[model samples]
Target: MDDTFPKIEVLINNLYDLKQKRDGNFEASVKRVLNMLMVLEKGLWRTTRGNPSSFTDSQVEKCSLQLWNWAVAENTLSTISDIDNAKFRHVACKLLTLSDPSSINERRVRLQIEMCLNAAQAWIVCGRYEMTDDLFELARTCIEKLLDGLAGQHHSLSGSKRMMLDRDLFSIDGLQFQCVGSLGEHDKAVIAFNCVRDKLALHPKEAPFLAMVCYNLALKFHKEGKLEECTYWLRQSYDTGKAEEEYKVDSCQQAKTLRFLAHVCLQWEAPHCWINALNAIELAIKEQPNVPGFLLYMKILTLSEAPDTDLISAVQKILKHNLPSDLVFNAVRMVMQNGRESACKTCLPFVCESLSHTTCGLEVILLKMEVALHFGNEDEAKKEAEDLIAKHHSGKMLKEMQQEHMHLLLWGRASFHIEAKCYADALVWYELSASFYAPGKLDCNLAKLYRNLATCYLELHRLNKAKESLSKAHRIEPDNPTTIFLNLRVALFEGDEQNASHAMDCLVQLANQEKDSVGRLESLPAEDQETPC
Candidate 1:
């Protein structure tokens, strides 16, 4: 009845012919045919007064599929190249209009939702945020229609059918949540998260989706530096995803969430941070059983001052897999610090093997220096330190781990002098190590650094300097028995009986069980270090 109908037929026939060819000009001909179809599509809508379904025949389904395939291809390419925006928008609009739930069959309705979501993602990648509105709206409309159809027949649908329905709805909602989050609509993202959370118990397979939503939101806040909110969402993700195992969902996501949570806890002063970090990494290792997870676990244990036995066990587990140089070096550091000479020796060869394969030769060589010092090979250690410093001055070290390795080297050099009773030489390295950190900042290493500095001054009979260093250490860690004991020693050396008596009483109360059981300062000076790096 419409004059444009024949034109559309001719265009489609030409499109079929173009598809049958695979020559140099096939792409051009296809584009020409698509353009002709588009023109006729616009004209048909302008002329038609009949029901919309009158146009959604077999020709329409075939056309929709072809257009969808083209849009998908273009959308993928848009990630790496620019696309024709005007043409993309025209095709998307036609797809949305033709996908109306009131016009297309149920199968086409579902296909249209998929198509719209694909287009919405492409538009997002293309930075056409405004164009996503219609695509998403059409998707929601199709989802709502599908949900309504399911609801009307809920009484007769089987349990599996009901589950499938819930999954489909939840999946759509989850995708929209992710898109809203990517758009930086924080409030809407939270609402979407709550929507998913509220319906979480309706289907067991929905846990992974909920976990992904929480993880994505946490990442957004993390990038924005909103640590408190980021931590809250990560906690939600790990807790909700923990039951993924019981529900038969993939446990890898939960493992990754745990690992990330551990990383965050290590940086922030979260409640029971070290304990939580240890627990999270331990669980992560169990869930995924991979090398990186094991490496993280070993690092956490070393920082947390877990017993040497635990560190040895982690090393043994790691030995079964291909060892990374960093992992081997860390393992050797922990064991050597714990006075496990045999364990350190066992791990050193692996470090050498792994080192040969990586560009991180500076770190591996530094580890060798520490081992030499631990074995009382003073000349070897001194020569290695000089070589390391010369190499550093030459800028031969890789930039990524240079700073961290240098800090460790400085600390090791300082601790070596402390053990040899070379107070003046020790004093210089300690001060140099302290200078590497920001002024007035305090951490485990800084706290111990101040304590050791006070020790050097005390040995040199610089009573005034000893008291000054003790004061700094005390302010940094008030409850440390070692700091209190150092304060007591300073008071004794200063002949200040009153302060000495007070420090003694505090230490007694701290020990409680044995008055003589006052904690010794950390023995391995290079050990028990916790750096953000």
Candidate 2:
């Protein structure tokens, strides 16, 4: 006898004994067992960590397997509190779920499959995709075994029952594909979909199913910024569903497809993209009227050649829908951006009504401050900015702000300080915003931020720093008129006539190309052209 063997035996016996005496004071007994398990788990973990050289991989795995078995044995898992309960079960199933379905007893195979899939789904809902591949694979293996059995005539499953099994197998594949895609395994996701495409084609009802899968895959690609792949898959989704007439596709699915297509067309800037977006959105609304989709349509129309009256009518129609504060704010922001002050004023009361009932998070609060600032409520905007700064420093925000949102807050505060003629304070905020730059991005917004920082530097008479900021902004967007004009200013300040002449020529060329730009350029003072203050 090993010294550790006796201790392990004692803990195991104690755990079992706790379950045996559960008839009296069941909850208390359960709590005791849970506490003991926690202690044992911690002890085992410490022991393994303390003497890592002494324990081989097999020993560590054996210890984990034993602990999981003890934790889940005899309906013990169900009694665990729902908090972190899904996580616990997901981990417990990792050791117990068999990859080879043939190894499980035939009678328990289906039950085991269901259990594994349910465990996998619980984590998926929580967006915890790690360690789920094994669970999904185990369930898929079991399902495929049953599917294979039917193919070989090993069982007398009815045609409908056989189809049910096929659908189950496909469902697993689709989910796994999306899950892997979400995990950033793009090639693996594509292969998974390709593996099932031929099989799905044999069933007409599966066409819509395939289309939905394509749509989901496209969304994943779109999020990853693989626009080419996203567009290809969207086209596939639309074509597949359109080819199947016997079993009509779901109207909601069609609407989702069309809405996504509209977004893609606009992003891609294809020929007549706006018109195509309008057509797609109109068809989508006809198929399924959803508030978010309708709002997207309104936004597109506002950006188009639609007359003010038509845009105002769209805004009026949108107001009739009871929307969340976020959506109402989006509508107001869109209209305000298009210079539709009448429409914006009409939507203001609804924003107030929605805000009164809902809890304001950082996003909604930020949008509200922007709405106030756009409407010339400078005092309110400044107050809100102060409150945001205090809350951020005190760490009292209800939710963690995302990188982009934090940048937005910093930019807004900097802009406010500039308006107040506090150059040093504005410089601090602007520099802080610049530090939040996301890697591998050279978008127009980022260039504008750099340009704004350069402006702050210029105002404070920091010519060297101003030059550096302008260089960064010019690198991001060389053709931007504002950036070129600022570059000209920087070069003139630095007494670099060569660079100043080059920047001036670029600006003149831009003005020549765009007739309206000439007047705007000439109107600015030669020495200090104000920078969109």
Candidate 3:
């Protein structure tokens, strides 16, 4: 018997009594806790020597929990706070060694894993986003060690044991990726993701696990802005997850994956995002009808500028859900840009009610601007725009959306002016819009901006400026019929007959291309007054 066991027991007894006091002397208590862990480390090794009496597994579990509590406590002693984190892995690794051999009892091995996992979870709950990576790393090391040892023992294990092992391994691998991603180590996260992917490959029959692996990878890459890879993995996760009893995966997980895939498609401007999202949500709703899933479906359905199918059924479904006021208001805002008077009117009452509430006031206000423009209520639209400017606070989401709103409102005013035949006013507004939204930037309707600016200049008889705007618009969307037609007009105005004839011939060919796309024009201006056609 190890003679040191007696001294260790005495140390633990004294430390346990001191900890039970929960005295205000946090530094003194942490120092005592460190002493206890140092003594417990020796005791953990004794369990490997077939000495069951040397240390109870419960003692290790309790110590692990105590250390976790100390680490995350808001008022933890600063001097010893980091000590608690450093000591955790030592105790966990010591316990891992105890669970090493098959000679160790199954109950003891399971207890050690559970204790380590609890410790890992504490790191997540207690550590700030920047500090949790080390916590997950400590937890992952223990799990990986366990998996490595268990792989050799798998042949003798029962089916249930195999499943438990697989699940634990899968969970830890996923947690590691999530933690790595949170730390913004994209390369490291991909390594962890690949590890999970390779593990899933080993068990090809586990569709749910496969989906989970893909789902996590998709999410990580999506957050990293690797959109192509994100889309690929999202499609894999969604497709595989939709296969069996609808993947027999968690309903929320299924819904989230499908929603993410739809979002990915939307980000890529894929033609099938809406249809696939609608179908996926329908299936997901049947399994577990969640508001987020439904709300996401509504976003896709209503926000579509040119949906291939009627969205009335989808919108009605949302109304039938009798969702919370916040969600209903949000849905109304999404459909506000649909440019359909009837649809916008259907949501008008809730939108007005939403404007009365505080949550998302800016978003609701901006949507009101768009909705007003949809109805050609220029005065109301102008009021909402001014209101948004008054209430605008600086934030990333708000700033981006605010810029978009300003651009569209400016465009709306220009269109209204053109429709009203106020040529000089149209020219002023269109020129301001073209300057605010430069032609070469992504996420701006630059082609239309330039084309319409050309139109405004032409109306004002600024033939040279009209030709310049038309040339810029042509470079962006070379084959756009509106751009080509305007190019012909600019050439004719400048008496460049050869260029006018070429522009006319190109316009005819593009008209054929436009006809081939029948009912699928990707670049139709939101307001019809954008072009002479």
| Backbone clash count for every predicted candidate, in the order shown | 0, 0, 1
Give the true-structure RMSD of model 1: 17.3
Can you write out model 1's per-residue Cα lDDT over 440-501, one digit (the tens) per residue?
A: 67776677777878878888888888888878877888887777777777788889999999
Candidate 2 vs candidate 3: which has greater TM-score?
Answer: 3
User: Which segments of model 2 are wrong by more than 4 Å?
Assistant: 1-105, 126-130, 140-155, 194-223, 229-257, 269-272, 289-533
Give a tens-digit lDDT track for model 2, residues 1-533.
12443354455466567667756675566566455545544455444443323334444344435544555564355554442444445444442331232332443456556557766766665667775787777777777666675557666677776676676676676667657766767678678777666566656677776787688778888988887788677877877777456865777888889889888767876557778788888787777777768787876787675666666666555556655545555666787788766666566555555464455544445665666666766567656555555554565443434345656656776767776878787776666556544456676767778778788787778888888888888788778787787777788888999999998888789988997775776665433322322
User: Which has the higher lDDT value, candidate number 1 or candidate number 3?
Assistant: 1
lDDT of candidates 1 onward, in order: 0.68, 0.65, 0.61
lDDT of 3 by residue, 178-228 (tens): 566555565786687677656654444566766776777677778788887
Q: What is the C-alpha local distance difference test score of candidate 1?
A: 0.68
In angstroms, give how far residue 489 of model 1 lies from its true place. 51
- Residue 499: error of model 3 in Å? 66
Minimal lDDT window, size 10, model 1 = 524-533
